[model samples]
Target: MAHERIEVDLPLAKVYELLCNPVHFTKFLERIDDVEKVNSQTFDYTTTIGGEEFQWTTNIIDNLRNTRFAWITINGNLNQTGTIRFTPLDSGKRTRVDFTLDYRTFFGEAEEDLAAFIEELPVQLKKDLQTFKDLAESDTFKDEESSSEKVASEVA
Candidate 1:
């Protein structure tokens, strides 16, 4: 079993919400083009990489607040299961996100040759997380202010 972890500078709940929402992926994830929500706990996305596109569907296996969420790949060109864990850091000023993607060979057979793939997954994932962190810590993350706040600012 190979493991990788990344910590983005956002609250755990914020990170969890972003990861579960496929609709917001394009704002940071480069390989994912679009996502269609099937229901409250299921979704599908079209992911493109290296000029190749594949459709994948995932079911929400677990959902928790400020802790973790797990998912299993339902249908896709590959087979994998993943988990995202959240840990509070610096007394809520920061959060550590740990993501792990586990998989076997396409035929369910294991071999030593697979390390190459595993080694690169974390690098790619970390870069994506960093981008999200930058966006989250900036002033442009979707602010959910109420109409009264908006009106007051406009009046001012």
Candidate 2:
């Protein structure tokens, strides 16, 4: 299991909106190569780690609006489950994100390999979280959100 936390200078709903969309993950998560939405509640992700590529399908098991989101792998080479919680701070002007991921290698893997992977997981997760923070705080993200809202309103 690995855990990472970051505070973003954005409203809870804004941060949660980005987190709920798998397509946005590639923008912030370095290891993620691509994400395909299988359905409203499921997604397929392709990622590369240490020059090795992996694919996984995950189903969103919990989604509590701007409060919490959780998912578990349904099938693939990777066995993983993760949860992200959003906490509003500064009276909803800011958000604190807590991310937790638990994963394991396939059976029969070398013990040393598993140990090394575990040791490096936290460092990678921290870096990814920082990237997420930067993305959430950037003007590009804000502009994109505003544009999308305008488009939606026009369509309605």
Candidate 3:
């Protein structure tokens, strides 16, 4: 099990909305190559990690608007379950993000391997979280949102 936290420079609702879109996962998650929506709450994804590419499917277990989003991988080379919780801070202009992951590696469950993963996981997680922060603060994401709203308004 590994847990990490990051503060994002965006409103809680905006962060939650961005995260709910699986299309943005690859942008923040390192080595993620593809994401295919299996259903409203399921996704099939491909990732390259440690020089190997594998496929995984994740089923969303719970989503509570801006509070929490949790999921479990049902089929994959790696078995993992994770949750992200959002807390409004700075008068709701920023969000404190909490993330947790419990994973069983594809490698044999040797004590040494598990320990190594445990030690290295935090570094990867921090990098990914920083990537997410950058994306959330970038103009590209804002442009995308504005474009989406434009289309929505036009359709109505």
Candidate 4:
């Protein structure tokens, strides 16, 4: 089990919106290669871990708007469950994100390597969280989203 937290200079709703979008994972997470929606609440993804690529599918178990996002791996090399919670701070101007991951390490015939990977999981997760922070706070992300929404509204 690994737990991590980070505070970001963004509203809870904004952060929650990012988390709820599965496609955003491929964009923000360095290890993620692709994210394909399987259904409304499920996605299939390819990710690189320790220089090896793994294919996985996950189902979104809980999605409490602007508050929490949780998922469990349905098929993958490892069995995993994770949750991310968003809490508003500074009167809803800032958000505190808490992330938790619980997983069983499985690396085919490479048992020894799994130990090292497990030890590094926390650091990797923290880095991923920081990457998310940098992305959410970036002007390019905001501008792109805003313009896309504007175009969508115009088309509608």
Candidate 5:
């Protein structure tokens, strides 16, 4: 479960490029340390999640010509298969991305229900889009938590 939708201001192709590049995941997925291609169709990912390090493998299922792409996570706490659809809007100046995640929990786990997870997904997903937007639109990207300093002027 845990369905989320994020819209990146970048073009469909640009977003697609970022998705296709497995190595680039480390930039956003801070938990992911490295990725290696085990074969032509499989990629292994090494990540440290919740202070626990683990490895996972995923397979590329289908990919359309800048239209849709799908994949599945072979092994992990987040076992889901989803697709990303790209739609051109505003006369191709912008692109709309539709992302869906579908998965199941073992049972009696902390996060089990899919519907409930989907409900509160927007907040987290939107934040991710903001970060993605900053990276895609400009060459600069601030750390996940970087704040601007406010200096007080002497008025008294």
Candidate 6:
């Protein structure tokens, strides 16, 4: 298992909304090539590592709006589960994200190779979290949010 905590400049609702939608994951998650929504609570993700592509389907196990989100992979090449907790900070002006991931490596790998992968998991997780934080804080995200709100308001 690997855990990482990051504080994002966006509000809790904004952060939670982003986290709930896997379609936005490719923007921040390293190696993720695509995410396709299977349903409101399920998605298919494709990732490439070392010139090999892996695909997985994930089902949402928990989705407490503005609180926490959890998911488990199923019927895919990867076996993994993860949870992300959202905490509002600065009176809802900002958010703190606590992310935890547990995964099993592919079968048939050498013991030494598994050990090396495990050793680097935490560092990779930390970097991924930082990347997410950076994306949430970027002006592009803000502009996108504004545009979405604008479209919603116009539709209303």
| Top-lDDT candidate index | 2
Query: Candidate 6's error at 2, in angstroms?
Result: 1.3
Q: Write the per-residue lDDT of candidate 3 for residues 1-156, one digit (tens) a residue.
A: 778899988899999998876656766666466677789999887765555666888899999999999989888876667899999999999999998876676667635544465567778788988878887888455444333245568999
Against the unseen true structure, what C-alpha lDDT does each candidate score?
Answer: 0.65, 0.79, 0.76, 0.76, 0.58, 0.76
Candidate No. with top TM-score: 2
Query: For residues 59-90, could you state the per-residue lDDT of candidate 5 as single tens digits?
Result: 87887867887778887554545576778767
Of candidates 5 and 3, the better by lDDT: 3
What's the C-alpha lDDT at position 112 in model 1? 42
Task: For candidate 1, list the clashing residue pairs, or say none.
Answer: none
TM-score: which is higher, 1 or 6? 6
Cα TM-score per model = 0.69, 0.81, 0.78, 0.79, 0.66, 0.79
Give lDDT: candidate 2, residue 9: 97
Residue 116 shift from truth in candidate 6, angstroms: 5.2
Q: After superposition, how far is residue 150 of candidate 2 from its true place, in Å?
A: 24
> Which pairs clash in the backbone of model 6?
none
Cα lDDT of model 1 by residue, 50-84, tens digit: 44555677787988867887877788764556677
Query: What is the alpha-carbon lDDT for the whole of candidate 5?
Result: 0.58
> Which candidate would rank higher by TM-score, 1 or 3?
3
Ranking the candidates on TM-score from highest down gives 2, 6, 4, 3, 1, 5
lDDT of 6 by residue, 1-156 (tens): 899999999999989987777767666666466777889989888765555566888899999889999999986765668899999999999999999887665565525544554567778789988878876788464344332345568999
Which of 1 and 4 is the better model by TM-score? 4
- In the range 1-156, model 4's lDDT, one tens digit per residue, is 779999999888888887787756655555556777889988887756667776778899999998899999889876667798899999999999998976564554445555566667788788988877887888445433333345568999
Residue 119 CA error for candidate 2 (Å)?
3.0
Distance from true location, Cα of 62 in model 1, Å:
0.9
